[model samples]
Target: MDGQLPIDTRPWPVRRDAALHDQTMQQTIGVVTKRLANAKVTAYAAYPEANHWRQRAVEVKRQSIRQLEEHLATFTQQVESHGGKVHRATTAADAIQTILEVAQHHQVRSVIKTKSMVTEELELNRALENAGIAVRETDLGEYIIQLAHEKPSHILAPALHKNREQIHALFDQDALVYHTEPPASEDIVALTQYARRRLREEFLAADMGVTGGNFLVAETGTVVLITNEGNADMVTTLPRLLVSVVGVEKIVADWSGLIDVIQQPALSGVGQRLSSYTTLVSGTRGPDQWEGPDEWHVVLLDNGRTQLKDTPFEDVLSCIRCGACLNVCPVFRQVGGHAYGSVYPGPIGIVETPLLTNFEVLPELPSALCTLCHACGEACPMNIDLPGHIVQLRQMKQERHMNAIGVTRSYRWWARFWATPHGYRRSMRWARWGQWWFVRHGRIQSAPGLAGGWFKTRDMPPVASMTFHEWWDRTRGKRQ
Candidate 1:
């Protein structure tokens, strides 16, 4: 439970209690995502050759995952050959224990970490801190959220929910402990500079550094960390021992395959032509090289991913963690990451949670949070049909009798009506009449039964006077 404290603190009860507080989160994510989406539009227009590259990237990822086990073994061997240690963790507990053991053996008192969603999913910081090690997050967004005792609301932008004023307040709070006062005026650049100076000391003093792998190339035995901020580079190179945690699906066959999967989505997701820093560390620094950590370790985590390897959901392995899907998802835009109640949020989490956990206990998970808009599918670099996967999960829930009664009844009623035209027409007429109570000025302010929630935030279109079949009959009956 202590290991899960960070996650439990932000559970459904906590999130619901904090929902109104998340209006700020909603606004912040909306502005950032919309801006990024628009930037993507302009960026794609400039790189007209992106579509060609996207298709190639998809093929490369598909080929890599198809031979994941073999490539992983090859990657392990190459890493070992280069004087790096490899640990295979079949479960989350094993991964955490392995990292903690490494930290303890090194007598690590303080650790610096780069932004890694894999570590977040595993709750690594809490695990390390519980083992009596002080862990500091080096990424600017991650550091802010860490101090605030909050989870990252977005994958890429951990503290996207925080405004400048909130940041200034946080810095001021920390300044009291340091017996120094922050600047009176609130500015992002100043705040960032202060954080950098503080983190620079932590970077030098920390016994170990930890990072999450964006991709693991089998041929070169390299763990790649892509970032716009260069925090990953510092974390990877500065400490005495460097520990990298990588999901099993992150393994690629070779550098060529790694390059393809990372390039397109890295740009599209963040609106960057390329990440400013792409660090590839195969092992520890040689005696000749003064920079880089003295010891390197890679922990490859299965963590339920193996169960999904060959299934219909296998395409999920193609995700590069660019987070474009989160930026484009309408439901994610509304509730933000905390409402989903998982470390991985948005479209990816909808598909991932069911596969990774006890779905029977969480039957409403995939359906309750999705709009079935297929926007995530369009944004996906590997062309993973995310909406189709969500539907598949819903079907699984139905077959297992895990679906909610309301959902089951609704589907049944729609199936029956669509099968019979006369029944459908009569239903539509009844619906129109029933909606009269809520209708005013040709818009429905409220609706009866389950649909009322839908009208709460959106305008419901007025029903048409006649069905399409009836209009077709009236116009072309003689010709028929």
Candidate 2:
């Protein structure tokens, strides 16, 4: 709504601590992530050729990105040829303005939206609501969070952080406004029926339908929507006017390219062979077509995407929002998405957010959000080097002198001590003696200053009485 990514003002520690203390959210996230992760493992185990397909997808995405400008130009030409309009937006503000202008020209009073992470980046729903246009999220998870006034906690399951009881409470409050009876019980069927009854009317009445594209076929000017639910189908077909806001990075060269990566999101995200719906829209309705939007518009948003080209971080653009990495990330599983306090979350977010924002937003994400686990890289179908990127980001942060003076000094002192045998031995002896202050029963329970963070939730055994080097010399013969 404010035409900017919701970069949280709170420090990372504060946000992370809040998430850690929220037992309900933490439990919900853990359960869902484990289920999704297990599903993906089952899916891949059944399909031995998955790795091959994943590699092909990575190559297709890389080629498309290398030729992004050409693809965009061809895509725009084909869309226009098919009676669709394309608007290029260099920034989030530009995209919002273009969408608003389209809505204004069409006299659109209300809009229906499918799940769109890019639009979330643009804060599209809030912008439209501020302009007096009613907007409703039609995706089941999106709808729940929309009513609860919360940002999505997971990429695929927006309300994965919320349990059934919490949803019942939100739905009960919403029912009061509609003057409708609440569900007889907290049954999933009863809840879904109530939502369907409420949203079906909006689907029929909305003047415009907005969606985010999973892939854009440059060869045919087609926008692809893959979802587990049929909401995207309704959003595309029922409204008089249609607007799709997609990142430029989503463009693929042709149908062959689209196929290479089409199944990756579903397979890696929820372990399905395919989603329930795959909606493709090329343009406005033709005279022969009876059930399609009268007008179609595509907004190609750069929003700093082009800047990644020809850089080491270029592969970060290949992300398909599959959320596989989130499921495997230990930190994400424990703390969830909201703790990252960025539009994109999990491993890829730690790399992409700072890169896309030119390091002006969430600069500490690399250091705070990740544990350098390569699990995300293995889970990613796009082969993005998330851990590698995170390391580079930390280096970049240091080069920019973004770390606090005390922290920098501490690291330097530690590094200097570890760099030499004498210093290392002295430091080890000092640590063994100093740790006694916080030791409880044989483990160091806590410490003061920076080291305290590591001991906050977990304890460590005190340094061994003898170093490995000392033990080697005393027991086995010394190498020299």
Candidate 3:
């Protein structure tokens, strides 16, 4: 939405700790994620055989990722079979160059885009601007972030961190929508209408329409774009050329998989049975057809995805980006997406970022984040097993950091020591003695060293003089 990456670029702990204390972010993220969590609950309860549908999605996704190349080839051949051109991009630069070339061929001046996270990954908007072409974000949340010069904080709800008053302020600052009435002062109806009226001009004048594919059905060579606001339809309706930049992983063999693709994401994301618009593009509009683009193009992006198929992270390729994981993630609920410092955020982002992008610099990303809650897996409509994938990444990271032989030995020593009954009791007794200095009124009011910061906002109960096992044995003996 910001037309730029909002990565903090600091150490992970520094960024996370900063976001933790940010009262505004805490309030905003907490309320929004919790509401989405509740909505997901209500939505799932209403659906029949929801778990069955989820399992079906997982099966479909696994099948697709395993034969990703075949499906992608079928998708491309079918698109070309239908008179649409397809470009295969191995990197972000390739995608941008492909899009630019398409723009050149079409003599594109202005472009109106729907919410496309892959496009954001390519920084397509900024690249277009650099090429002296104008780009407008048609999605409402995306538009706000574009105006604010900030990246999307959430995958589905880009402006999740901002409230209505904040949104009104953002609109107020935009010179494009200003008039005598000042745009209805926090009225959702007025704000939407104001945006709709203005965006219509952008849509009408756009030479090209760009979108991200939710699912590409290979059998018929169709690109599916879903949106709740009908903005994608508006963008596609009148442009001279339509281009979809899609990840190779988004392709499915046929229509049988498309229904679950549509329904599961909607149920997990906005809790809707279906999104308001599910636009399917096969080819350029014919004279017999009502109205559509004159040209159609599909850009299939690799961007390190090929490497994932054989790796332990292959399951990650199956993600549908429904963002249900984000809604239920305790870590995401607190810090939000910006703290993760990636285009992809939440549980999925941490797992994928290293695999897709620079693992050298972002080596600690997964271990730095994730509480290993498994809530993400429960929420994932595709059942991607996010925690399992995270553990793999952690193992990979630990191997690299295993150069610290002393730290490894000490950690292993402690882990083994604590595993024995005698060591456990001795350690517990010593820990109780050690904490006696910090205990007050049945709680450890403070802790020493690095632990002190943790207790700054938290309290732990003091350890009892006797172990639970000892107490249980004595109580049982008395009962007997």
- State the local distance difference test value for candidate 1: 0.83
Q: Where is the poorest 10-residue window by lDDT in model 3?
A: 1-10
By lDDT rank, best first, the candidates go 2, 1, 3
Write candidate 2's Cα lDDT for 1-480 as tens digits: 112466767888899999999999999999999999999999999999998998999999999999999999999999999989999998899999999999998788999999999999999998999999999999999999999988888888899999999989988998999898886679999889888888998999999999999999999999999988799999999998999999999999999989999999999999998898999999889999898889999999998888888999999989899999999999999899999999889998898888888788888889988888799988888889998999999999998999998889999999999999999999988998898999999999999878988898999999998878789889886555
Report the number of the highest-lDDT candidate.
2
Each prediction's number of clashing residue pairs: 0, 0, 0
- Model 1 lowest lDDT segment of ten: 1-10
Tens digit of per-residue lDDT, candidate 1, span 1-480:
111212433445466556546777778878988887777778878897888888988898888889999999999999999889999987778889999999999899999999998899789998999999999999999999998998998888888778888888998898887776574568777898889877888888998999998889999899998887898888988888999999988888887777677776567777777888898899888889898888999999887777777888889888777788888999878778777777778898888777776472334558778889999988887788889999999888889888668868887988898789788887888887887888888888888667878888987877877667778889987799
Candidate 3 off by > 4 Å: 1-6, 176-181, 402-410, 432-453, 461-463, 468-480
TM-score of each: 0.90, 0.95, 0.90
Candidate 2 residue runs with Cα over 4 Å from true position? 1-4, 432-449, 457-459, 474-480
List, residue by residue over 92-115, the lDDT tens digit for candidate 3.
888899999989877789999999
Cα lDDT, all candidates:
0.83, 0.91, 0.82
lDDT of 2 at 480: 57
